[model samples]
Target chain A: MNLQVELEHHRRVLIVRLRGELDHHTAEAVRTKMDEAIQRGRAEHLVLSLEDLTFMDSSGLGVILGRYKVIKSLGGKMVVCHVNPSVHRLFELSGLFKILAIYENERTALSELEVVS
Target chain B: MSEKLEQISDHDGNFMTLQFASRSENEAFARVAVAAFVTQLDPTMDELTDLKTVVSEAVTNCIIHGYDNDPNGVVTITARIEEEIVTITIEDKGNGIEDLELAKQPLYTSKPELERSGMGFTIMENFMDEFEVVSNLGSGTHIRMKKRIESKKALYN
Candidate 1:
Protein backbone atom coordinates (compact mmCIF):
# COMPACT_ATOMS: atom_id res chain seq x y z
CA MET A 1 0.00 0.00 0.00
CA ASN A 2 2.97 2.28 0.68
CA LEU A 3 5.87 2.72 -1.67
CA GLN A 4 9.31 2.68 -0.02
CA VAL A 5 11.61 5.18 -1.71
CA GLU A 6 15.39 4.94 -1.38
CA LEU A 7 17.58 7.62 -2.90
CA GLU A 8 21.09 7.05 -4.19
CA HIS A 9 23.36 9.67 -5.66
CA HIS A 10 26.20 9.07 -8.11
CA ARG A 11 27.69 12.44 -8.91
CA ARG A 12 24.80 14.27 -10.65
CA VAL A 13 22.84 11.12 -11.37
CA LEU A 14 20.18 10.22 -8.82
CA ILE A 15 19.08 6.63 -8.64
CA VAL A 16 15.63 6.16 -7.11
CA ARG A 17 14.72 2.70 -5.98
CA LEU A 18 10.98 2.17 -5.58
CA ARG A 19 9.63 -0.88 -3.78
CA GLY A 20 5.87 -1.40 -3.57
CA GLU A 21 2.71 -0.55 -5.48
CA LEU A 22 2.93 2.42 -7.88
CA ASP A 23 -0.67 3.06 -8.73
CA HIS A 24 -2.80 6.20 -8.62
CA HIS A 25 -2.91 5.86 -4.86
CA THR A 26 0.85 6.32 -4.45
CA ALA A 27 1.73 8.22 -7.65
CA GLU A 28 1.12 11.70 -6.25
CA ALA A 29 3.27 11.06 -3.20
CA VAL A 30 6.02 9.66 -5.39
CA ARG A 31 5.92 12.68 -7.69
CA THR A 32 6.11 14.98 -4.70
CA LYS A 33 8.88 13.04 -3.00
CA MET A 34 10.98 12.65 -6.14
CA ASP A 35 10.29 16.19 -7.25
CA GLU A 36 11.68 17.46 -4.00
CA ALA A 37 14.73 15.28 -4.45
CA ILE A 38 15.21 16.52 -7.99
CA GLN A 39 14.90 20.16 -6.92
CA ARG A 40 17.64 19.72 -4.35
CA GLY A 41 20.18 20.69 -7.06
CA ARG A 42 22.15 17.47 -6.77
CA ALA A 43 20.85 15.70 -9.84
CA GLU A 44 21.75 16.24 -13.47
CA HIS A 45 20.17 12.92 -14.48
CA LEU A 46 17.79 10.35 -13.03
CA VAL A 47 17.65 6.55 -12.94
CA LEU A 48 14.80 4.53 -11.47
CA SER A 49 15.14 0.97 -10.20
CA LEU A 50 11.81 -0.86 -10.09
CA GLU A 51 13.15 -4.28 -9.28
CA ASP A 52 10.88 -4.56 -6.28
CA LEU A 53 7.95 -2.64 -7.72
CA THR A 54 5.01 -4.97 -7.00
CA PHE A 55 2.40 -3.21 -9.10
CA MET A 56 1.83 -0.23 -11.41
CA ASP A 57 -0.88 1.21 -13.67
CA SER A 58 -1.47 4.16 -16.00
CA SER A 59 -1.26 6.60 -13.16
CA GLY A 60 2.21 5.30 -12.46
CA LEU A 61 3.03 5.84 -16.11
CA GLY A 62 1.75 9.40 -15.84
CA VAL A 63 4.07 10.03 -12.90
CA ILE A 64 7.03 8.73 -14.85
CA LEU A 65 6.07 10.75 -17.90
CA GLY A 66 5.55 13.80 -15.76
CA ARG A 67 9.04 13.43 -14.28
CA TYR A 68 10.50 12.88 -17.74
CA LYS A 69 9.12 16.25 -18.78
CA VAL A 70 10.69 17.94 -15.80
CA ILE A 71 14.06 16.37 -16.51
CA LYS A 72 13.82 17.18 -20.21
CA SER A 73 12.98 20.77 -19.46
CA LEU A 74 16.23 20.95 -17.50
CA GLY A 75 18.16 19.33 -20.37
CA GLY A 76 18.88 16.27 -18.22
CA LYS A 77 18.28 12.61 -19.00
CA MET A 78 16.01 10.04 -17.33
CA VAL A 79 16.19 6.28 -17.63
CA VAL A 80 14.34 3.45 -15.90
CA CYS A 81 15.95 0.17 -15.02
CA HIS A 82 14.86 -3.18 -13.54
CA VAL A 83 11.35 -2.81 -14.94
CA ASN A 84 9.28 -5.96 -14.59
CA PRO A 85 7.94 -7.33 -17.85
CA SER A 86 4.38 -6.31 -17.02
CA VAL A 87 5.46 -2.74 -16.36
CA HIS A 88 7.73 -2.82 -19.39
CA ARG A 89 4.70 -3.59 -21.55
CA LEU A 90 3.13 -0.41 -20.27
CA PHE A 91 6.19 1.59 -21.26
CA GLU A 92 5.91 0.09 -24.71
CA LEU A 93 2.16 0.69 -24.87
CA SER A 94 2.61 4.31 -23.81
CA GLY A 95 5.57 4.77 -26.13
CA LEU A 96 7.85 5.69 -23.23
CA PHE A 97 10.67 3.45 -24.39
CA LYS A 98 11.09 5.63 -27.48
CA ILE A 99 12.05 8.58 -25.30
CA LEU A 100 13.30 6.96 -22.09
CA ALA A 101 15.75 4.11 -22.24
CA ILE A 102 14.92 0.91 -20.30
CA TYR A 103 17.96 -0.82 -18.93
CA GLU A 104 18.39 -4.29 -17.53
CA ASN A 105 19.92 -3.13 -14.27
CA GLU A 106 21.42 -0.14 -12.50
CA ARG A 107 24.89 -0.89 -13.76
CA THR A 108 23.78 -0.86 -17.40
CA ALA A 109 21.70 2.23 -16.85
CA LEU A 110 24.57 4.09 -15.21
CA SER A 111 26.97 2.97 -17.91
CA GLU A 112 24.65 4.15 -20.65
CA LEU A 113 24.12 7.47 -18.94
CA GLU A 114 27.92 7.78 -18.84
CA VAL A 115 27.82 8.19 -15.08
CA VAL A 116 30.14 6.09 -12.96
CA SER A 117 28.34 4.48 -10.06
CA MET B 1 -22.90 0.25 0.64
CA SER B 2 -21.43 -1.95 3.31
CA GLU B 3 -17.67 -1.90 3.60
CA LYS B 4 -17.47 -5.46 4.79
CA LEU B 5 -16.37 -8.28 2.49
CA GLU B 6 -19.22 -10.78 2.00
CA GLN B 7 -18.99 -14.27 0.64
CA ILE B 8 -21.80 -15.89 -1.35
CA SER B 9 -21.31 -19.24 -2.96
CA ASP B 10 -23.54 -21.45 -5.09
CA HIS B 11 -23.27 -24.44 -7.41
CA ASP B 12 -22.08 -22.17 -10.20
CA GLY B 13 -19.03 -21.09 -8.19
CA ASN B 14 -18.04 -19.42 -4.97
CA PHE B 15 -18.04 -15.62 -5.10
CA MET B 16 -16.94 -12.90 -2.74
CA THR B 17 -18.09 -9.30 -2.87
CA LEU B 18 -16.21 -6.27 -1.60
CA GLN B 19 -17.83 -2.88 -1.26
CA PHE B 20 -15.72 0.11 -0.35
CA ALA B 21 -15.75 3.87 -0.63
CA SER B 22 -14.43 5.51 -3.75
CA ARG B 23 -11.02 6.31 -2.37
CA SER B 24 -7.66 6.13 -4.08
CA GLU B 25 -6.28 3.79 -1.46
CA ASN B 26 -8.87 1.19 -2.32
CA GLU B 27 -7.26 0.87 -5.71
CA ALA B 28 -4.34 -0.93 -4.11
CA PHE B 29 -6.68 -2.92 -1.92
CA ALA B 30 -8.76 -3.99 -4.89
CA ARG B 31 -5.79 -5.48 -6.77
CA VAL B 32 -3.91 -7.08 -3.92
CA ALA B 33 -6.99 -8.48 -2.27
CA VAL B 34 -8.28 -9.95 -5.51
CA ALA B 35 -4.83 -11.26 -6.34
CA ALA B 36 -4.79 -12.99 -3.00
CA PHE B 37 -8.13 -14.62 -3.75
CA VAL B 38 -7.01 -15.71 -7.20
CA THR B 39 -3.89 -17.29 -5.74
CA GLN B 40 -5.92 -20.42 -4.96
CA LEU B 41 -6.28 -21.03 -8.68
CA ASP B 42 -2.54 -21.40 -9.00
CA PRO B 43 -2.21 -18.71 -11.62
CA THR B 44 1.15 -17.96 -13.09
CA MET B 45 2.87 -14.81 -11.94
CA ASP B 46 2.14 -13.11 -15.25
CA GLU B 47 -1.51 -14.13 -15.13
CA LEU B 48 -1.89 -12.83 -11.62
CA THR B 49 -0.19 -9.58 -12.52
CA ASP B 50 -2.46 -9.17 -15.52
CA LEU B 51 -5.55 -9.59 -13.37
CA LYS B 52 -4.29 -7.12 -10.81
CA THR B 53 -3.47 -4.52 -13.46
CA VAL B 54 -6.93 -4.67 -14.99
CA VAL B 55 -8.54 -4.54 -11.55
CA SER B 56 -6.53 -1.44 -10.68
CA GLU B 57 -7.46 0.32 -13.92
CA ALA B 58 -11.15 -0.48 -13.55
CA VAL B 59 -11.35 0.61 -9.92
CA THR B 60 -9.43 3.81 -10.66
CA ASN B 61 -11.84 4.70 -13.45
CA CYS B 62 -14.71 4.24 -11.04
CA ILE B 63 -13.11 6.42 -8.40
CA ILE B 64 -11.74 9.23 -10.59
CA HIS B 65 -14.03 9.38 -13.58
CA GLY B 66 -17.23 7.85 -12.24
CA TYR B 67 -17.30 9.36 -8.78
CA ASP B 68 -15.38 12.47 -9.83
CA ASN B 69 -13.00 11.92 -6.92
CA ASP B 70 -15.82 12.31 -4.43
CA PRO B 71 -15.11 10.31 -1.31
CA ASN B 72 -18.80 9.65 -0.69
CA GLY B 73 -19.19 7.51 -3.75
CA VAL B 74 -19.02 3.72 -3.52
CA VAL B 75 -17.37 1.12 -5.69
CA THR B 76 -18.34 -2.54 -5.58
CA ILE B 77 -15.99 -5.27 -6.68
CA THR B 78 -17.06 -8.89 -7.15
CA ALA B 79 -14.49 -11.51 -8.03
CA ARG B 80 -15.31 -15.16 -8.68
CA ILE B 81 -13.03 -17.89 -9.93
CA GLU B 82 -14.97 -20.87 -11.21
CA GLU B 83 -12.67 -23.62 -12.36
CA GLU B 84 -9.86 -21.95 -14.28
CA ILE B 85 -11.69 -18.79 -15.36
CA VAL B 86 -11.94 -15.69 -13.20
CA THR B 87 -14.66 -13.09 -13.54
CA ILE B 88 -14.55 -9.67 -11.98
CA THR B 89 -16.99 -6.82 -11.97
CA ILE B 90 -16.33 -3.26 -10.73
CA GLU B 91 -19.29 -0.93 -10.52
CA ASP B 92 -19.89 2.62 -9.34
CA LYS B 93 -22.97 4.77 -8.89
CA GLY B 94 -21.64 8.05 -10.22
CA ASN B 95 -21.71 10.11 -13.38
CA GLY B 96 -20.93 7.79 -16.27
CA ILE B 97 -19.17 8.18 -19.55
CA GLU B 98 -20.96 10.02 -22.33
CA ASP B 99 -18.99 8.56 -25.17
CA LEU B 100 -17.81 5.00 -24.72
CA GLU B 101 -15.92 4.95 -28.00
CA LEU B 102 -13.98 8.13 -27.29
CA ALA B 103 -13.35 7.13 -23.73
CA LYS B 104 -11.79 3.83 -24.74
CA GLN B 105 -9.49 5.41 -27.26
CA PRO B 106 -5.86 5.09 -26.30
CA LEU B 107 -4.33 8.27 -24.88
CA TYR B 108 -7.71 10.00 -24.84
CA THR B 109 -8.55 11.28 -21.40
CA SER B 110 -11.43 13.46 -20.28
CA LYS B 111 -9.12 15.09 -17.76
CA PRO B 112 -5.72 15.56 -19.29
CA GLU B 113 -5.00 18.23 -16.72
CA LEU B 114 -5.04 15.51 -14.08
CA GLU B 115 -2.14 13.84 -15.90
CA ARG B 116 -4.38 10.94 -16.87
CA SER B 117 -2.81 8.83 -19.59
CA GLY B 118 -6.25 7.47 -20.60
CA MET B 119 -4.91 3.99 -21.12
CA GLY B 120 -7.13 2.44 -18.46
CA PHE B 121 -9.59 0.76 -20.76
CA THR B 122 -6.87 -0.21 -23.18
CA ILE B 123 -4.93 -1.99 -20.51
CA MET B 124 -8.05 -3.69 -19.27
CA GLU B 125 -8.82 -4.90 -22.77
CA ASN B 126 -5.33 -6.21 -23.31
CA PHE B 127 -4.96 -7.90 -19.95
CA MET B 128 -8.27 -9.72 -19.77
CA ASP B 129 -9.57 -12.25 -22.25
CA GLU B 130 -12.99 -10.63 -22.12
CA PHE B 131 -13.70 -7.00 -21.28
CA GLU B 132 -17.07 -5.28 -21.31
CA VAL B 133 -17.97 -1.70 -20.42
CA VAL B 134 -21.50 -0.53 -19.61
CA SER B 135 -22.13 3.10 -18.81
CA ASN B 136 -24.78 5.75 -19.13
CA LEU B 137 -24.21 9.47 -18.84
CA GLY B 138 -25.71 10.92 -15.66
CA SER B 139 -26.07 7.37 -14.33
CA GLY B 140 -23.09 5.17 -13.47
CA THR B 141 -20.61 2.69 -14.94
CA HIS B 142 -20.08 -1.04 -14.75
CA ILE B 143 -17.09 -3.01 -16.05
CA ARG B 144 -16.99 -6.79 -16.31
CA MET B 145 -13.82 -8.67 -17.16
CA LYS B 146 -12.96 -12.35 -17.38
CA LYS B 147 -9.90 -14.39 -18.14
CA ARG B 148 -9.20 -18.10 -18.36
CA ILE B 149 -6.01 -18.37 -16.38
CA GLU B 150 -3.49 -20.73 -17.86
CA SER B 151 -3.09 -23.66 -15.53
CA LYS B 152 0.24 -25.31 -14.92
CA LYS B 153 -0.78 -28.25 -17.02
CA ALA B 154 -1.57 -26.07 -19.99
CA LEU B 155 1.83 -24.45 -19.85
CA TYR B 156 3.69 -27.74 -19.91
CA ASN B 157 1.74 -29.48 -22.63
Candidate 2:
Protein backbone atom coordinates (compact mmCIF):
# COMPACT_ATOMS: atom_id res chain seq x y z
CA MET A 1 0.00 0.00 0.00
CA ASN A 2 2.08 2.91 -1.29
CA LEU A 3 0.59 6.44 -1.08
CA GLN A 4 2.40 8.78 -3.40
CA VAL A 5 1.72 12.53 -3.28
CA GLU A 6 3.21 14.84 -5.87
CA LEU A 7 2.99 18.60 -5.46
CA GLU A 8 2.80 20.81 -8.53
CA HIS A 9 2.82 24.48 -7.71
CA HIS A 10 1.64 27.18 -10.08
CA ARG A 11 2.18 30.35 -8.10
CA ARG A 12 -0.45 30.01 -5.32
CA VAL A 13 -2.16 26.86 -6.67
CA LEU A 14 -1.06 23.39 -5.47
CA ILE A 15 -2.03 20.10 -7.12
CA VAL A 16 -1.53 16.94 -5.06
CA ARG A 17 -1.74 13.52 -6.70
CA LEU A 18 -2.70 10.59 -4.48
CA ARG A 19 -2.38 6.90 -5.37
CA GLY A 20 -3.34 3.88 -3.22
CA GLU A 21 -5.77 2.85 -0.53
CA LEU A 22 -6.74 5.52 2.01
CA ASP A 23 -7.87 3.73 5.12
CA HIS A 24 -7.24 4.06 8.85
CA HIS A 25 -3.74 2.61 8.44
CA THR A 26 -2.75 5.18 5.80
CA ALA A 27 -4.90 8.24 6.48
CA GLU A 28 -2.45 9.59 9.05
CA ALA A 29 0.41 9.37 6.60
CA VAL A 30 -1.63 11.19 3.96
CA ARG A 31 -2.58 13.91 6.41
CA THR A 32 1.04 14.40 7.37
CA LYS A 33 2.21 14.55 3.79
CA MET A 34 -0.46 17.01 2.73
CA ASP A 35 0.18 19.20 5.73
CA GLU A 36 3.89 19.28 4.95
CA ALA A 37 3.20 20.25 1.35
CA ILE A 38 0.86 23.07 2.34
CA GLN A 39 3.31 24.46 4.86
CA ARG A 40 6.40 24.17 2.68
CA GLY A 41 4.80 24.88 -0.68
CA ARG A 42 2.88 27.91 0.69
CA ALA A 43 0.04 27.04 -1.65
CA GLU A 44 -3.13 29.11 -1.57
CA HIS A 45 -5.21 26.56 -3.54
CA LEU A 46 -5.18 22.75 -3.30
CA VAL A 47 -6.34 20.22 -5.87
CA LEU A 48 -6.39 16.55 -4.96
CA SER A 49 -5.95 14.16 -7.88
CA LEU A 50 -7.33 10.77 -6.90
CA GLU A 51 -7.15 9.11 -10.29
CA ASP A 52 -5.11 6.14 -9.11
CA LEU A 53 -6.67 5.56 -5.71
CA THR A 54 -7.99 2.01 -5.53
CA PHE A 55 -9.85 1.97 -2.20
CA MET A 56 -11.01 4.29 0.56
CA ASP A 57 -13.11 3.94 3.69
CA SER A 58 -14.48 6.48 6.16
CA SER A 59 -10.96 7.16 7.32
CA GLY A 60 -10.24 8.57 3.90
CA LEU A 61 -13.22 10.88 4.29
CA GLY A 62 -11.69 12.15 7.52
CA VAL A 63 -8.49 13.08 5.72
CA ILE A 64 -10.31 14.99 3.01
CA LEU A 65 -12.63 16.75 5.42
CA GLY A 66 -9.72 17.64 7.66
CA ARG A 67 -7.85 19.17 4.75
CA TYR A 68 -10.90 21.07 3.67
CA LYS A 69 -11.13 22.61 7.09
CA VAL A 70 -7.48 23.47 7.07
CA ILE A 71 -7.64 25.12 3.65
CA LYS A 72 -10.80 27.02 4.52
CA SER A 73 -9.12 28.43 7.61
CA LEU A 74 -6.14 29.49 5.54
CA GLY A 75 -8.41 31.32 3.06
CA GLY A 76 -7.66 28.77 0.33
CA LYS A 77 -9.90 26.53 -1.81
CA MET A 78 -9.91 22.72 -2.15
CA VAL A 79 -10.85 20.62 -5.16
CA VAL A 80 -11.08 16.86 -5.85
CA CYS A 81 -10.71 15.16 -9.20
CA HIS A 82 -10.87 11.79 -10.96
CA VAL A 83 -12.77 9.83 -8.33
CA ASN A 84 -13.47 6.22 -9.33
CA PRO A 85 -16.91 4.68 -8.85
CA SER A 86 -16.30 2.96 -5.51
CA VAL A 87 -14.59 6.00 -4.02
CA HIS A 88 -17.09 8.30 -5.71
CA ARG A 89 -19.94 6.62 -3.90
CA LEU A 90 -18.18 7.25 -0.61
CA PHE A 91 -17.71 10.90 -1.44
CA GLU A 92 -21.37 11.25 -2.36
CA LEU A 93 -22.56 9.51 0.79
CA SER A 94 -20.32 11.64 2.96
CA GLY A 95 -21.55 14.81 1.24
CA LEU A 96 -17.99 16.00 0.67
CA PHE A 97 -18.90 17.16 -2.81
CA LYS A 98 -21.24 19.69 -1.26
CA ILE A 99 -18.39 21.20 0.70
CA LEU A 100 -15.43 20.71 -1.65
CA ALA A 101 -15.44 21.37 -5.38
CA ILE A 102 -15.12 18.24 -7.55
CA TYR A 103 -13.70 18.40 -11.05
CA GLU A 104 -13.88 15.80 -13.80
CA ASN A 105 -10.09 15.55 -14.05
CA GLU A 106 -6.93 16.95 -12.53
CA ARG A 107 -6.16 19.17 -15.50
CA THR A 108 -9.57 20.82 -15.21
CA ALA A 109 -9.29 21.19 -11.48
CA LEU A 110 -5.86 22.73 -11.81
CA SER A 111 -7.03 25.05 -14.54
CA GLU A 112 -9.98 26.16 -12.44
CA LEU A 113 -7.56 27.12 -9.68
CA GLU A 114 -5.23 29.00 -12.03
CA VAL A 115 -3.09 31.52 -10.19
CA VAL A 116 -3.10 35.17 -11.29
CA SER A 117 0.58 34.94 -12.19
CA MET B 1 -12.71 -32.91 18.10
CA SER B 2 -14.67 -29.81 17.20
CA GLU B 3 -12.43 -26.98 16.11
CA LYS B 4 -13.21 -23.36 16.94
CA LEU B 5 -13.36 -22.64 13.24
CA GLU B 6 -14.47 -25.61 11.15
CA GLN B 7 -15.67 -25.97 7.57
CA ILE B 8 -19.15 -27.43 7.38
CA SER B 9 -20.69 -29.45 4.56
CA ASP B 10 -23.27 -27.99 2.22
CA HIS B 11 -25.53 -30.97 2.82
CA ASP B 12 -26.66 -28.96 5.80
CA GLY B 13 -25.28 -25.89 4.02
CA ASN B 14 -22.09 -24.77 2.26
CA PHE B 15 -20.26 -23.16 5.17
CA MET B 16 -16.67 -22.29 6.02
CA THR B 17 -15.07 -20.73 9.10
CA LEU B 18 -11.93 -18.62 9.46
CA GLN B 19 -10.04 -17.32 12.51
CA PHE B 20 -8.01 -14.18 12.02
CA ALA B 21 -6.04 -11.72 14.08
CA SER B 22 -7.75 -8.49 14.98
CA ARG B 23 -5.58 -6.48 12.65
CA SER B 24 -6.05 -4.54 9.43
CA GLU B 25 -4.42 -7.30 7.39
CA ASN B 26 -7.16 -9.68 8.54
CA GLU B 27 -9.76 -7.46 6.90
CA ALA B 28 -8.10 -8.11 3.53
CA PHE B 29 -8.10 -11.82 4.28
CA ALA B 30 -11.80 -11.69 5.13
CA ARG B 31 -12.58 -10.19 1.72
CA VAL B 32 -10.57 -12.87 -0.07
CA ALA B 33 -12.21 -15.61 1.98
CA VAL B 34 -15.65 -14.36 1.04
CA ALA B 35 -14.80 -14.06 -2.65
CA ALA B 36 -13.40 -17.59 -2.71
CA PHE B 37 -16.34 -19.07 -0.81
CA VAL B 38 -18.94 -17.44 -3.06
CA THR B 39 -17.15 -18.09 -6.36
CA GLN B 40 -18.70 -21.55 -6.68
CA LEU B 41 -22.13 -20.00 -6.60
CA ASP B 42 -21.40 -17.76 -9.60
CA PRO B 43 -22.94 -14.64 -8.15
CA THR B 44 -23.75 -11.62 -10.28
CA MET B 45 -22.05 -8.26 -10.03
CA ASP B 46 -24.66 -6.77 -7.71
CA GLU B 47 -24.56 -9.82 -5.46
CA LEU B 48 -20.77 -9.70 -5.33
CA THR B 49 -20.86 -6.01 -4.43
CA ASP B 50 -23.36 -6.62 -1.65
CA LEU B 51 -21.32 -9.49 -0.25
CA LYS B 52 -18.10 -7.52 -0.32
CA THR B 53 -19.67 -4.50 1.36
CA VAL B 54 -21.30 -6.59 4.07
CA VAL B 55 -18.09 -8.52 4.74
CA SER B 56 -16.06 -5.33 4.89
CA GLU B 57 -18.41 -3.73 7.40
CA ALA B 58 -18.48 -6.81 9.60
CA VAL B 59 -14.70 -7.22 9.63
CA THR B 60 -14.17 -3.53 10.21
CA ASN B 61 -16.49 -3.47 13.21
CA CYS B 62 -14.70 -6.47 14.65
CA ILE B 63 -11.33 -4.83 14.36
CA ILE B 64 -12.16 -1.23 15.26
CA HIS B 65 -15.06 -1.41 17.71
CA GLY B 66 -15.04 -5.01 18.93
CA TYR B 67 -11.30 -5.31 19.39
CA ASP B 68 -10.84 -1.65 20.32
CA ASN B 69 -7.71 -1.56 18.16
CA ASP B 70 -6.18 -4.33 20.23
CA PRO B 71 -3.87 -6.24 17.92
CA ASN B 72 -3.91 -9.31 20.16
CA GLY B 73 -7.65 -9.81 19.84
CA VAL B 74 -9.10 -12.58 17.68
CA VAL B 75 -11.91 -12.43 15.14
CA THR B 76 -13.78 -15.45 13.82
CA ILE B 77 -15.74 -15.32 10.59
CA THR B 78 -18.06 -18.06 9.44
CA ALA B 79 -20.06 -18.30 6.24
CA ARG B 80 -22.76 -20.85 5.55
CA ILE B 81 -25.14 -21.47 2.70
CA GLU B 82 -28.48 -23.11 3.34
CA GLU B 83 -30.74 -23.59 0.36
CA GLU B 84 -30.83 -20.12 -1.23
CA ILE B 85 -29.62 -18.20 1.80
CA VAL B 86 -26.07 -17.21 2.70
CA THR B 87 -25.32 -16.53 6.36
CA ILE B 88 -22.16 -14.94 7.74
CA THR B 89 -21.19 -14.54 11.37
CA ILE B 90 -18.35 -12.40 12.74
CA GLU B 91 -17.44 -12.74 16.38
CA ASP B 92 -14.87 -10.86 18.45
CA LYS B 93 -13.71 -11.04 22.06
CA GLY B 94 -13.31 -7.42 23.01
CA ASN B 95 -15.19 -4.74 24.88
CA GLY B 96 -18.66 -5.66 23.74
CA ILE B 97 -21.11 -2.96 22.80
CA GLU B 98 -23.05 -1.70 25.79
CA ASP B 99 -26.26 -0.90 23.99
CA LEU B 100 -27.17 -2.84 20.87
CA GLU B 101 -29.98 -0.47 19.93
CA LEU B 102 -27.84 2.65 20.15
CA ALA B 103 -25.03 0.92 18.33
CA LYS B 104 -27.36 0.06 15.44
CA GLN B 105 -28.44 3.65 14.98
CA PRO B 106 -27.11 5.14 11.78
CA LEU B 107 -24.09 7.46 12.20
CA TYR B 108 -23.73 6.53 15.85
CA THR B 109 -20.14 5.80 16.82
CA SER B 110 -18.39 5.30 20.10
CA LYS B 111 -15.13 6.58 18.71
CA PRO B 112 -15.98 9.78 16.95
CA GLU B 113 -12.41 11.06 17.22
CA LEU B 114 -11.32 8.35 14.80
CA GLU B 115 -13.76 9.82 12.22
CA ARG B 116 -15.75 6.61 12.21
CA SER B 117 -19.09 7.22 10.52
CA GLY B 118 -20.72 4.66 12.79
CA MET B 119 -22.61 3.51 9.74
CA GLY B 120 -21.20 -0.01 9.80
CA PHE B 121 -24.39 -1.55 11.16
CA THR B 122 -26.51 0.56 8.85
CA ILE B 123 -24.56 -0.52 5.76
CA MET B 124 -24.67 -4.16 6.84
CA GLU B 125 -28.41 -3.96 7.37
CA ASN B 126 -28.95 -2.37 3.99
CA PHE B 127 -26.81 -4.90 2.12
CA MET B 128 -27.95 -8.06 3.90
CA ASP B 129 -31.47 -9.46 4.09
CA GLU B 130 -31.19 -9.93 7.84
CA PHE B 131 -28.74 -8.48 10.37
CA GLU B 132 -28.35 -9.37 14.04
CA VAL B 133 -25.95 -8.14 16.68
CA VAL B 134 -25.55 -10.05 19.96
CA SER B 135 -23.16 -8.78 22.58
CA ASN B 136 -22.31 -8.72 26.29
CA LEU B 137 -20.72 -5.78 28.02
CA GLY B 138 -17.39 -7.43 28.81
CA SER B 139 -17.69 -10.70 26.91
CA GLY B 140 -17.78 -10.13 23.15
CA THR B 141 -19.92 -9.21 20.15
CA HIS B 142 -21.38 -11.48 17.51
CA ILE B 143 -22.74 -10.15 14.24
CA ARG B 144 -24.77 -12.46 12.04
CA MET B 145 -26.12 -11.50 8.64
CA LYS B 146 -27.97 -13.38 5.89
CA LYS B 147 -28.75 -12.78 2.24
CA ARG B 148 -30.76 -14.88 -0.19
CA ILE B 149 -28.99 -15.87 -3.36
CA GLU B 150 -30.84 -14.49 -6.36
CA SER B 151 -31.82 -17.30 -8.65
CA LYS B 152 -30.95 -17.16 -12.37
CA LYS B 153 -34.62 -16.95 -13.20
CA ALA B 154 -34.80 -13.67 -11.31
CA LEU B 155 -31.63 -12.32 -12.91
CA TYR B 156 -32.24 -13.10 -16.62
CA ASN B 157 -35.99 -12.55 -16.71
Kindly list the per-residue Cα lDDT of model 1 for residues B2-87, writing each as its tens digit: 33333245337767788899999888888989999888888999998899899999999998999989999999999887878899
Candidate-wise lDDT, in order:
0.89, 0.77
| lDDT (Cα, tens digit) per residue for candidate 1, span A8-100 | 999779999999899998888899889999999799899999999988899998889888998889889999999888998998887888998
TM-score versus the correct structure, for each prediction? 0.92, 0.83
C-alpha RMSD between model 1 and the true structure: 3.0
Model 1's interface RMSD: 0.7
lDDT of 2 by residue, B1-157 (tens): 1654343552586778788888876665676688679766667766766677677778788788888888899998888877667888889888899988998887678888876766677768876899898999888999998888786436656
CAPRI quality of model 2: acceptable
User: How does chain A of every candidate compare to the true chain A by TM-score?
Assistant: 0.94, 0.91
Please provide, for model 2 over A12-107, each residue's C-alpha lDDT reduced to its tens digit, 9 standing for 90 to 100: 888888886666666778889898888885799898989888656666777888888888898889999997776676666657778888889977
The prediction achieving the highest lDDT against the true structure is 1
What is model 2's DockQ versus the real complex? 0.33
TM-score of 1: 0.92
Model 2 misplaced regions, further than 4 Å: A2-7, A115-117, B1-11, B149-157
